[model samples]
Target: MRLNNKVIIVTGSCTGIGKAIALRCVAEGASVVVHGLEQDLGEAVINEIEKDKGVLQIEEITNEGAPERLVELAVKTFGKLDAVVNNAAMILSSNMETTDLAFLRKVLDVNTVAPFALIKAAFPYLAKEGGCVLNIGSVNAWSGEPNLFAYSVSKGALMTMTRNLGDTLFRESGVRVNQINPGWVLTETEIQRKRSQGLKDDWYKDISSVYAPAGRILWPSEIAAAAIYWLANESGPISGQVVDLEQYPLIGRNPPKN
Candidate 1:
Protein backbone atom coordinates (compact mmCIF):
# COMPACT_ATOMS: atom_id res chain seq x y z
CA MET A 1 0.00 0.00 0.00
CA ARG A 2 3.01 2.24 0.05
CA LEU A 3 2.69 3.09 -3.62
CA ASN A 4 -1.03 3.04 -3.97
CA ASN A 5 -2.34 4.12 -7.40
CA LYS A 6 1.13 4.95 -8.62
CA VAL A 7 2.38 4.08 -12.10
CA ILE A 8 6.02 3.28 -12.80
CA ILE A 9 8.29 2.30 -15.67
CA VAL A 10 10.94 -0.36 -15.00
CA THR A 11 13.46 -0.76 -17.80
CA GLY A 12 15.15 -4.09 -18.54
CA SER A 13 12.63 -5.69 -16.25
CA CYS A 14 12.13 -8.99 -18.02
CA THR A 15 14.62 -10.62 -15.66
CA GLY A 16 16.89 -10.13 -12.70
CA ILE A 17 16.75 -6.99 -10.52
CA GLY A 18 14.46 -5.02 -12.82
CA LYS A 19 11.91 -7.86 -12.91
CA ALA A 20 11.94 -8.09 -9.15
CA ILE A 21 11.34 -4.34 -8.78
CA ALA A 22 8.41 -4.41 -11.22
CA LEU A 23 6.66 -7.22 -9.37
CA ARG A 24 7.24 -5.64 -5.98
CA CYS A 25 5.78 -2.35 -7.19
CA VAL A 26 2.59 -4.08 -8.23
CA ALA A 27 2.34 -5.84 -4.89
CA GLU A 28 2.52 -2.46 -3.19
CA GLY A 29 -0.52 -1.24 -5.18
CA ALA A 30 1.25 0.42 -8.09
CA SER A 31 0.77 -0.33 -11.80
CA VAL A 32 3.96 -0.97 -13.81
CA VAL A 33 5.33 -0.77 -17.34
CA VAL A 34 7.42 -3.92 -17.73
CA HIS A 35 10.09 -3.55 -20.43
CA GLY A 36 13.02 -5.56 -21.76
CA LEU A 37 14.74 -6.86 -24.87
CA GLU A 38 12.98 -10.25 -24.80
CA GLN A 39 9.34 -10.34 -25.77
CA ASP A 40 8.61 -13.73 -24.20
CA LEU A 41 10.20 -12.77 -20.93
CA GLY A 42 8.41 -9.43 -20.88
CA GLU A 43 5.07 -11.15 -21.48
CA ALA A 44 5.79 -13.66 -18.77
CA VAL A 45 6.49 -10.93 -16.27
CA ILE A 46 3.29 -9.10 -17.16
CA ASN A 47 1.34 -12.35 -16.81
CA GLU A 48 2.78 -12.99 -13.37
CA ILE A 49 1.61 -9.63 -12.04
CA GLU A 50 -2.02 -8.72 -11.60
CA LYS A 51 -3.98 -8.50 -14.82
CA ASP A 52 -4.62 -4.78 -14.46
CA LYS A 53 -1.35 -3.95 -12.79
CA GLY A 54 1.15 -4.47 -15.57
CA VAL A 55 1.90 -3.88 -19.28
CA LEU A 56 4.80 -5.03 -21.46
CA GLN A 57 7.20 -3.32 -23.88
CA ILE A 58 9.98 -5.06 -25.79
CA GLU A 59 12.82 -2.93 -27.13
CA GLU A 60 16.46 -2.01 -26.78
CA ILE A 61 16.92 0.89 -24.38
CA THR A 62 19.33 2.64 -26.72
CA ASN A 63 17.06 2.38 -29.75
CA GLU A 64 15.88 5.67 -31.19
CA GLY A 65 12.75 7.00 -29.45
CA ALA A 66 12.62 4.00 -27.11
CA PRO A 67 12.61 6.19 -24.02
CA GLU A 68 9.64 8.17 -25.25
CA ARG A 69 7.75 5.00 -26.01
CA LEU A 70 8.29 3.63 -22.51
CA VAL A 71 6.95 6.81 -20.95
CA GLU A 72 4.00 6.78 -23.30
CA LEU A 73 3.20 3.19 -22.33
CA ALA A 74 2.96 4.10 -18.65
CA VAL A 75 0.80 7.14 -19.27
CA LYS A 76 -1.44 5.47 -21.82
CA THR A 77 -1.98 2.26 -19.87
CA PHE A 78 -1.85 3.34 -16.26
CA GLY A 79 -2.99 6.98 -16.69
CA LYS A 80 0.23 8.63 -15.44
CA LEU A 81 3.85 8.09 -14.47
CA ASP A 82 4.96 8.38 -10.88
CA ALA A 83 8.39 6.78 -10.97
CA VAL A 84 11.06 5.31 -13.21
CA VAL A 85 13.57 2.61 -12.29
CA ASN A 86 16.44 2.87 -14.76
CA ASN A 87 17.62 -0.74 -14.51
CA ALA A 88 18.67 -1.56 -18.06
CA ALA A 89 22.41 -1.86 -18.63
CA MET A 90 25.05 -3.73 -20.58
CA ILE A 91 27.50 -5.52 -18.34
CA LEU A 92 30.61 -6.26 -20.36
CA SER A 93 34.11 -7.03 -19.26
CA SER A 94 37.17 -5.35 -20.74
CA ASN A 95 40.62 -4.30 -19.66
CA MET A 96 42.42 -1.15 -20.83
CA GLU A 97 44.25 -3.12 -23.49
CA THR A 98 41.14 -4.83 -24.79
CA THR A 99 38.71 -1.89 -24.64
CA ASP A 100 38.20 0.03 -27.86
CA LEU A 101 36.34 3.27 -28.70
CA ALA A 102 33.34 1.41 -30.09
CA PHE A 103 33.17 -0.97 -27.16
CA LEU A 104 33.27 1.86 -24.61
CA ARG A 105 30.69 3.90 -26.55
CA LYS A 106 28.31 0.94 -26.69
CA VAL A 107 28.56 0.44 -22.98
CA LEU A 108 27.97 4.15 -22.35
CA ASP A 109 25.04 4.18 -24.72
CA VAL A 110 23.13 1.57 -22.74
CA ASN A 111 24.24 2.19 -19.16
CA THR A 112 24.54 5.96 -19.16
CA VAL A 113 22.88 7.66 -22.14
CA ALA A 114 19.81 5.46 -22.29
CA PRO A 115 18.89 6.01 -18.65
CA PHE A 116 19.22 9.75 -19.03
CA ALA A 117 16.98 9.72 -22.06
CA LEU A 118 14.27 7.83 -20.18
CA ILE A 119 14.44 10.27 -17.30
CA LYS A 120 14.06 13.19 -19.67
CA ALA A 121 11.05 11.63 -21.29
CA ALA A 122 9.43 10.93 -17.94
CA PHE A 123 10.25 14.30 -16.42
CA PRO A 124 6.96 16.07 -17.14
CA TYR A 125 4.77 13.29 -15.74
CA LEU A 126 7.01 12.79 -12.74
CA ALA A 127 6.92 16.47 -11.96
CA LYS A 128 3.16 16.45 -12.10
CA GLU A 129 2.98 13.79 -9.41
CA GLY A 130 6.08 14.75 -7.45
CA GLY A 131 7.43 11.38 -8.53
CA CYS A 132 10.86 9.78 -8.23
CA VAL A 133 13.69 8.13 -10.13
CA LEU A 134 15.66 5.21 -8.74
CA ASN A 135 18.75 4.33 -10.73
CA ILE A 136 20.10 0.79 -10.21
CA GLY A 137 23.82 1.37 -10.15
CA SER A 138 26.75 -0.79 -9.03
CA VAL A 139 29.40 -0.63 -6.34
CA ASN A 140 31.82 -0.67 -9.24
CA ALA A 141 31.04 3.03 -9.76
CA TRP A 142 34.00 3.56 -7.49
CA SER A 143 37.16 2.00 -8.83
CA GLY A 144 35.83 -1.18 -10.35
CA GLU A 145 37.59 -4.46 -11.02
CA PRO A 146 40.33 -4.38 -13.65
CA ASN A 147 38.28 -6.36 -16.13
CA LEU A 148 35.29 -4.01 -15.90
CA PHE A 149 36.85 -0.85 -17.31
CA ALA A 150 34.07 0.29 -19.63
CA TYR A 151 31.27 -0.85 -17.38
CA SER A 152 32.74 0.95 -14.39
CA VAL A 153 33.13 4.16 -16.32
CA SER A 154 29.52 4.02 -17.43
CA LYS A 155 28.24 3.45 -13.92
CA GLY A 156 30.44 6.22 -12.60
CA ALA A 157 28.85 8.66 -15.03
CA LEU A 158 25.39 7.44 -14.04
CA MET A 159 26.15 8.04 -10.37
CA THR A 160 27.25 11.59 -11.09
CA MET A 161 24.15 12.25 -13.15
CA THR A 162 21.95 10.89 -10.40
CA ARG A 163 23.46 13.29 -7.88
CA ASN A 164 23.29 16.29 -10.19
CA LEU A 165 19.73 15.63 -11.28
CA GLY A 166 18.67 14.62 -7.80
CA ASP A 167 19.59 18.10 -6.62
CA THR A 168 18.45 20.20 -9.57
CA LEU A 169 15.35 18.22 -10.47
CA PHE A 170 14.14 18.05 -6.91
CA ARG A 171 14.52 21.76 -6.60
CA GLU A 172 13.11 22.63 -10.00
CA SER A 173 10.45 20.01 -10.64
CA GLY A 174 9.78 18.28 -7.32
CA VAL A 175 10.98 15.00 -8.80
CA ARG A 176 13.35 13.18 -6.49
CA VAL A 177 16.34 11.38 -7.97
CA ASN A 178 18.39 8.81 -6.09
CA GLN A 179 20.61 5.81 -6.73
CA ILE A 180 21.28 2.42 -5.14
CA ASN A 181 24.66 0.81 -5.73
CA PRO A 182 24.14 -2.90 -5.22
CA GLY A 183 27.05 -5.29 -4.74
CA TRP A 184 27.26 -8.91 -5.87
CA VAL A 185 23.59 -9.56 -6.32
CA LEU A 186 22.76 -13.17 -7.23
CA THR A 187 20.50 -12.37 -10.14
CA GLU A 188 19.45 -14.77 -12.89
CA THR A 189 21.69 -12.95 -15.37
CA GLU A 190 24.57 -13.16 -12.90
CA ILE A 191 24.18 -16.93 -12.61
CA GLN A 192 24.47 -17.32 -16.37
CA ARG A 193 27.19 -14.71 -16.54
CA LYS A 194 29.38 -16.57 -14.09
CA ARG A 195 28.77 -19.88 -15.82
CA SER A 196 29.79 -18.38 -19.14
CA GLN A 197 33.04 -17.24 -17.53
CA GLY A 198 33.91 -20.96 -17.27
CA LEU A 199 32.95 -21.31 -13.64
CA LYS A 200 31.02 -24.37 -12.53
CA ASP A 201 27.22 -24.31 -12.39
CA ASP A 202 27.26 -24.03 -8.61
CA TRP A 203 30.02 -21.47 -8.39
CA TYR A 204 27.86 -19.15 -6.31
CA LYS A 205 27.34 -21.86 -3.73
CA ASP A 206 30.88 -21.47 -2.45
CA ILE A 207 31.88 -17.83 -2.71
CA SER A 208 34.96 -16.51 -0.93
CA SER A 209 34.07 -15.04 2.44
CA VAL A 210 35.86 -11.88 1.51
CA TYR A 211 33.35 -11.31 -1.27
CA ALA A 212 30.26 -12.54 0.54
CA PRO A 213 30.67 -12.11 4.24
CA ALA A 214 27.13 -13.31 4.82
CA GLY A 215 27.91 -16.57 3.00
CA ARG A 216 25.73 -15.59 0.01
CA ILE A 217 25.39 -12.78 -2.42
CA LEU A 218 22.48 -10.36 -2.09
CA TRP A 219 19.20 -11.23 -3.75
CA PRO A 220 17.09 -9.27 -6.24
CA SER A 221 14.20 -9.18 -3.80
CA GLU A 222 16.40 -7.53 -1.23
CA ILE A 223 17.28 -4.82 -3.69
CA ALA A 224 13.63 -4.45 -4.61
CA ALA A 225 12.70 -3.95 -0.97
CA ALA A 226 15.15 -1.07 -0.74
CA ALA A 227 13.86 0.39 -3.99
CA ILE A 228 10.37 0.72 -2.60
CA TYR A 229 11.57 3.27 -0.09
CA TRP A 230 12.75 5.59 -2.83
CA LEU A 231 9.80 5.06 -5.15
CA ALA A 232 7.27 5.62 -2.37
CA ASN A 233 6.46 8.99 -0.84
CA GLU A 234 8.12 7.99 2.39
CA SER A 235 11.40 9.27 1.00
CA GLY A 236 10.22 12.88 1.10
CA PRO A 237 12.55 15.69 0.09
CA ILE A 238 15.56 13.36 0.24
CA SER A 239 17.43 13.56 -3.06
CA GLY A 240 20.92 13.45 -4.50
CA GLN A 241 21.84 10.40 -2.41
CA VAL A 242 23.69 7.23 -3.40
CA VAL A 243 23.34 4.21 -1.14
CA ASP A 244 25.56 1.13 -1.30
CA LEU A 245 23.78 -2.13 -0.58
CA GLU A 246 26.58 -4.63 -0.03
CA GLN A 247 27.55 -7.30 2.49
CA TYR A 248 31.05 -6.00 3.15
CA PRO A 249 32.68 -2.60 3.26
CA LEU A 250 33.04 -1.21 -0.24
CA ILE A 251 35.96 0.87 0.91
CA GLY A 252 38.79 0.76 3.45
CA ARG A 253 38.39 -2.92 4.17
CA ASN A 254 41.28 -5.33 4.33
CA PRO A 255 40.03 -8.85 3.84
CA PRO A 256 41.71 -11.76 5.55
CA LYS A 257 43.82 -14.10 3.42
CA ASN A 258 42.32 -17.25 2.01
Candidate 2:
Protein backbone atom coordinates (compact mmCIF):
# COMPACT_ATOMS: atom_id res chain seq x y z
CA MET A 1 0.00 0.00 0.00
CA ARG A 2 1.76 3.11 -1.18
CA LEU A 3 -0.38 5.35 1.04
CA ASN A 4 -0.55 3.10 4.05
CA ASN A 5 -1.87 4.88 7.15
CA LYS A 6 -2.26 8.15 5.26
CA VAL A 7 -5.31 10.40 5.56
CA ILE A 8 -6.45 12.34 2.50
CA ILE A 9 -9.18 14.92 1.99
CA VAL A 10 -10.66 14.73 -1.50
CA THR A 11 -13.01 17.61 -2.31
CA GLY A 12 -15.96 17.02 -4.69
CA SER A 13 -15.57 13.27 -4.27
CA CYS A 14 -19.25 12.47 -4.67
CA THR A 15 -18.78 12.01 -8.40
CA GLY A 16 -16.48 11.95 -11.37
CA ILE A 17 -12.72 12.37 -11.03
CA GLY A 18 -12.94 13.20 -7.36
CA LYS A 19 -14.88 9.99 -6.64
CA ALA A 20 -12.37 7.93 -8.54
CA ILE A 21 -9.50 9.46 -6.58
CA ALA A 22 -11.22 8.80 -3.26
CA LEU A 23 -11.85 5.16 -4.13
CA ARG A 24 -8.28 4.70 -5.27
CA CYS A 25 -6.91 6.29 -2.12
CA VAL A 26 -8.81 3.87 0.06
CA ALA A 27 -7.55 0.93 -1.99
CA GLU A 28 -4.02 2.18 -1.34
CA GLY A 29 -4.67 2.11 2.45
CA ALA A 30 -5.39 5.78 3.04
CA SER A 31 -8.50 6.69 4.96
CA VAL A 32 -10.35 9.42 3.07
CA VAL A 33 -12.69 12.30 3.78
CA VAL A 34 -15.00 12.23 0.77
CA HIS A 35 -16.67 15.58 0.11
CA GLY A 36 -19.27 17.06 -2.24
CA LEU A 37 -22.51 19.03 -2.40
CA GLU A 38 -24.81 16.09 -3.04
CA GLN A 39 -25.69 14.18 0.07
CA ASP A 40 -26.97 10.99 -1.53
CA LEU A 41 -24.08 10.85 -3.94
CA GLY A 42 -21.61 11.42 -1.12
CA GLU A 43 -23.26 8.62 0.83
CA ALA A 44 -23.07 6.38 -2.20
CA VAL A 45 -19.32 6.91 -2.26
CA ILE A 46 -19.16 6.12 1.43
CA ASN A 47 -21.13 2.90 0.89
CA GLU A 48 -18.73 1.73 -1.78
CA ILE A 49 -15.76 2.03 0.53
CA GLU A 50 -15.66 0.26 3.84
CA LYS A 51 -17.41 2.26 6.55
CA ASP A 52 -14.21 2.70 8.47
CA LYS A 53 -12.05 3.69 5.51
CA GLY A 54 -14.08 6.67 4.30
CA VAL A 55 -16.24 9.48 5.65
CA LEU A 56 -18.39 12.16 3.99
CA GLN A 57 -18.53 15.97 4.10
CA ILE A 58 -21.16 17.88 2.17
CA GLU A 59 -20.57 21.57 1.52
CA GLU A 60 -20.16 24.01 -1.31
CA ILE A 61 -16.42 24.68 -1.67
CA THR A 62 -16.90 28.46 -1.64
CA ASN A 63 -19.16 28.68 1.35
CA GLU A 64 -17.78 30.61 4.28
CA GLY A 65 -15.95 28.38 6.76
CA ALA A 66 -16.28 25.44 4.34
CA PRO A 67 -12.53 24.90 4.20
CA GLU A 68 -12.18 24.85 7.94
CA ARG A 69 -15.14 22.50 8.25
CA LEU A 70 -13.56 20.04 5.83
CA VAL A 71 -10.21 20.22 7.56
CA GLU A 72 -11.94 19.74 10.86
CA LEU A 73 -13.76 16.68 9.58
CA ALA A 74 -10.57 15.06 8.32
CA VAL A 75 -8.74 15.66 11.55
CA LYS A 76 -11.67 14.74 13.76
CA THR A 77 -12.35 11.51 11.89
CA PHE A 78 -8.85 10.37 11.06
CA GLY A 79 -6.82 12.15 13.76
CA LYS A 80 -4.75 14.09 11.17
CA LEU A 81 -4.53 15.10 7.55
CA ASP A 82 -1.81 13.75 5.28
CA ALA A 83 -2.91 15.33 1.99
CA VAL A 84 -5.50 17.61 0.40
CA VAL A 85 -6.82 16.97 -3.13
CA ASN A 86 -8.25 20.25 -4.42
CA ASN A 87 -10.59 18.64 -6.93
CA ALA A 88 -13.73 20.75 -6.62
CA ALA A 89 -14.35 23.44 -9.24
CA MET A 90 -17.02 25.34 -11.15
CA ILE A 91 -16.72 24.82 -14.91
CA LEU A 92 -19.14 27.14 -16.62
CA SER A 93 -19.25 27.90 -20.32
CA SER A 94 -19.41 31.59 -21.18
CA ASN A 95 -17.84 33.97 -23.64
CA MET A 96 -16.50 37.42 -22.79
CA GLU A 97 -19.90 38.98 -23.44
CA THR A 98 -21.65 36.64 -21.06
CA THR A 99 -19.00 36.60 -18.36
CA ASP A 100 -19.89 39.61 -16.27
CA LEU A 101 -17.91 40.65 -13.23
CA ALA A 102 -20.24 38.65 -10.98
CA PHE A 103 -19.95 35.58 -13.16
CA LEU A 104 -16.18 35.76 -13.17
CA ARG A 105 -16.07 36.24 -9.42
CA LYS A 106 -18.35 33.25 -8.83
CA VAL A 107 -16.16 31.07 -11.04
CA LEU A 108 -13.02 32.25 -9.27
CA ASP A 109 -14.59 31.66 -5.88
CA VAL A 110 -15.03 27.97 -6.46
CA ASN A 111 -12.24 27.19 -8.88
CA THR A 112 -9.45 29.31 -7.46
CA VAL A 113 -10.16 30.87 -4.09
CA ALA A 114 -11.62 27.79 -2.42
CA PRO A 115 -8.57 25.65 -3.16
CA PHE A 116 -6.29 28.22 -1.58
CA ALA A 117 -8.55 28.44 1.44
CA LEU A 118 -8.51 24.70 1.93
CA ILE A 119 -4.75 24.55 1.58
CA LYS A 120 -4.35 27.30 4.16
CA ALA A 121 -6.68 25.49 6.52
CA ALA A 122 -4.87 22.20 6.12
CA PHE A 123 -1.35 23.60 6.07
CA PRO A 124 -0.58 23.05 9.72
CA TYR A 125 -1.50 19.38 9.59
CA LEU A 126 0.26 18.84 6.26
CA ALA A 127 3.42 20.52 7.57
CA LYS A 128 3.50 18.28 10.58
CA GLU A 129 3.50 15.21 8.36
CA GLY A 130 5.40 16.48 5.31
CA GLY A 131 2.21 16.01 3.30
CA CYS A 132 1.25 17.44 -0.08
CA VAL A 133 -1.48 19.26 -2.04
CA LEU A 134 -2.64 18.03 -5.45
CA ASN A 135 -4.70 20.54 -7.36
CA ILE A 136 -6.81 19.21 -10.25
CA GLY A 137 -6.43 21.81 -12.93
CA SER A 138 -7.13 21.85 -16.68
CA VAL A 139 -5.25 22.33 -19.96
CA ASN A 140 -7.59 25.28 -20.47
CA ALA A 141 -5.35 27.11 -18.04
CA TRP A 142 -3.47 27.96 -21.22
CA SER A 143 -5.79 30.50 -22.93
CA GLY A 144 -8.64 27.95 -23.05
CA GLU A 145 -11.51 27.62 -25.51
CA PRO A 146 -13.28 30.84 -26.48
CA ASN A 147 -16.47 29.75 -24.76
CA LEU A 148 -14.84 29.10 -21.39
CA PHE A 149 -13.55 32.56 -20.60
CA ALA A 150 -14.13 32.74 -16.87
CA TYR A 151 -13.34 29.11 -16.26
CA SER A 152 -10.06 29.30 -18.13
CA VAL A 153 -9.09 32.47 -16.32
CA SER A 154 -9.76 30.86 -12.95
CA LYS A 155 -7.64 27.84 -13.77
CA GLY A 156 -4.86 30.03 -15.01
CA ALA A 157 -4.84 31.78 -11.65
CA LEU A 158 -4.85 28.39 -9.97
CA MET A 159 -1.83 27.27 -11.98
CA THR A 160 0.11 30.33 -10.89
CA MET A 161 -0.94 29.75 -7.30
CA THR A 162 0.28 26.17 -7.50
CA ARG A 163 3.69 27.22 -8.73
CA ASN A 164 4.01 30.04 -6.20
CA LEU A 165 2.98 27.92 -3.24
CA GLY A 166 4.53 24.68 -4.37
CA ASP A 167 7.87 26.40 -3.96
CA THR A 168 7.17 28.58 -0.96
CA LEU A 169 5.25 25.99 1.07
CA PHE A 170 7.70 23.21 0.32
CA ARG A 171 10.62 25.34 1.42
CA GLU A 172 8.87 26.78 4.43
CA SER A 173 7.31 23.62 5.89
CA GLY A 174 8.32 20.58 3.82
CA VAL A 175 4.77 20.42 2.45
CA ARG A 176 4.70 19.81 -1.28
CA VAL A 177 2.24 21.52 -3.60
CA ASN A 178 1.64 20.31 -7.14
CA GLN A 179 -1.02 20.36 -9.84
CA ILE A 180 -2.22 18.03 -12.63
CA ASN A 181 -3.89 19.56 -15.67
CA PRO A 182 -6.04 16.91 -17.28
CA GLY A 183 -7.36 17.10 -20.81
CA TRP A 184 -10.89 16.12 -21.77
CA VAL A 185 -12.04 13.52 -19.27
CA LEU A 186 -15.27 11.54 -19.70
CA THR A 187 -16.93 12.02 -16.38
CA GLU A 188 -20.61 12.03 -15.39
CA THR A 189 -20.79 15.82 -15.24
CA GLU A 190 -19.33 16.04 -18.72
CA ILE A 191 -21.91 13.60 -19.99
CA GLN A 192 -24.65 15.79 -18.58
CA ARG A 193 -22.97 18.98 -19.72
CA LYS A 194 -22.64 17.79 -23.28
CA ARG A 195 -26.19 16.52 -23.28
CA SER A 196 -27.46 19.78 -21.94
CA GLN A 197 -25.64 21.53 -24.76
CA GLY A 198 -27.78 19.53 -27.24
CA LEU A 199 -25.19 16.91 -28.13
CA LYS A 200 -26.43 13.37 -28.78
CA ASP A 201 -26.48 10.80 -26.00
CA ASP A 202 -23.35 9.09 -27.34
CA TRP A 203 -21.49 12.28 -28.19
CA TYR A 204 -18.28 11.05 -26.62
CA LYS A 205 -18.26 7.86 -28.69
CA ASP A 206 -17.04 9.58 -31.85
CA ILE A 207 -14.67 12.35 -30.87
CA SER A 208 -12.56 13.91 -33.61
CA SER A 209 -8.84 13.12 -33.64
CA VAL A 210 -8.14 16.74 -32.80
CA TYR A 211 -9.74 16.34 -29.41
CA ALA A 212 -9.07 12.70 -28.65
CA PRO A 213 -6.04 11.24 -30.38
CA ALA A 214 -6.66 7.80 -28.86
CA GLY A 215 -10.24 7.72 -30.25
CA ARG A 216 -11.63 8.61 -26.82
CA ILE A 217 -11.21 11.02 -23.98
CA LEU A 218 -9.29 10.22 -20.79
CA TRP A 219 -10.90 8.45 -17.88
CA PRO A 220 -11.28 9.54 -14.27
CA SER A 221 -9.49 6.43 -13.09
CA GLU A 222 -6.50 7.27 -15.29
CA ILE A 223 -6.29 10.69 -13.69
CA ALA A 224 -6.64 9.10 -10.27
CA ALA A 225 -3.77 6.71 -11.01
CA ALA A 226 -1.56 9.65 -11.86
CA ALA A 227 -2.68 11.50 -8.73
CA ILE A 228 -1.41 8.73 -6.49
CA TYR A 229 2.17 9.43 -7.46
CA TRP A 230 2.08 13.01 -6.22
CA LEU A 231 0.24 12.15 -3.04
CA ALA A 232 2.53 9.26 -2.21
CA ASN A 233 5.95 9.78 -0.69
CA GLU A 234 7.49 8.26 -3.82
CA SER A 235 7.28 11.72 -5.48
CA GLY A 236 10.10 12.79 -3.13
CA PRO A 237 11.55 16.28 -2.95
CA ILE A 238 9.46 17.40 -5.95
CA SER A 239 7.26 20.49 -5.64
CA GLY A 240 5.86 23.45 -7.56
CA GLN A 241 5.29 21.32 -10.67
CA VAL A 242 2.34 21.46 -13.09
CA VAL A 243 1.88 18.33 -15.17
CA ASP A 244 -0.45 18.35 -18.16
CA LEU A 245 -2.04 14.94 -18.75
CA GLU A 246 -3.33 14.95 -22.28
CA GLN A 247 -3.22 12.74 -25.34
CA TYR A 248 -1.46 15.33 -27.51
CA PRO A 249 0.65 18.42 -27.13
CA LEU A 250 -1.79 21.06 -25.99
CA ILE A 251 0.12 23.75 -27.79
CA GLY A 252 0.92 24.09 -31.50
CA ARG A 253 -0.44 20.70 -32.57
CA ASN A 254 -2.01 20.69 -36.03
CA PRO A 255 -4.75 18.14 -36.50
CA PRO A 256 -5.11 16.38 -39.84
CA LYS A 257 -7.78 17.92 -42.02
CA ASN A 258 -8.55 14.53 -43.47
Extract clashing residue pairs from model 1: none
Residue-by-residue lDDT tens digits, candidate 1, 129-240: 9899999999999989899999999999999999999999999989999999999999888899889999999999999888998899999999999999999988889999
**Ten-residue stretch with the least lDDT total in model 2:** 249-258
User: Residue 151 lDDT in model 2?
Assistant: 93
- Which whole-number lDDT from 0 to 100 does residue 242 have in model 1? 98
- Give the per-residue Cα lDDT of candidate 1 at 86: 98
Q: How accurate is candidate 2 locally (lDDT)?
A: 0.96
Q: Residue 159 lDDT in model 2?
A: 100
Residue 131 lDDT (model 2) = 97
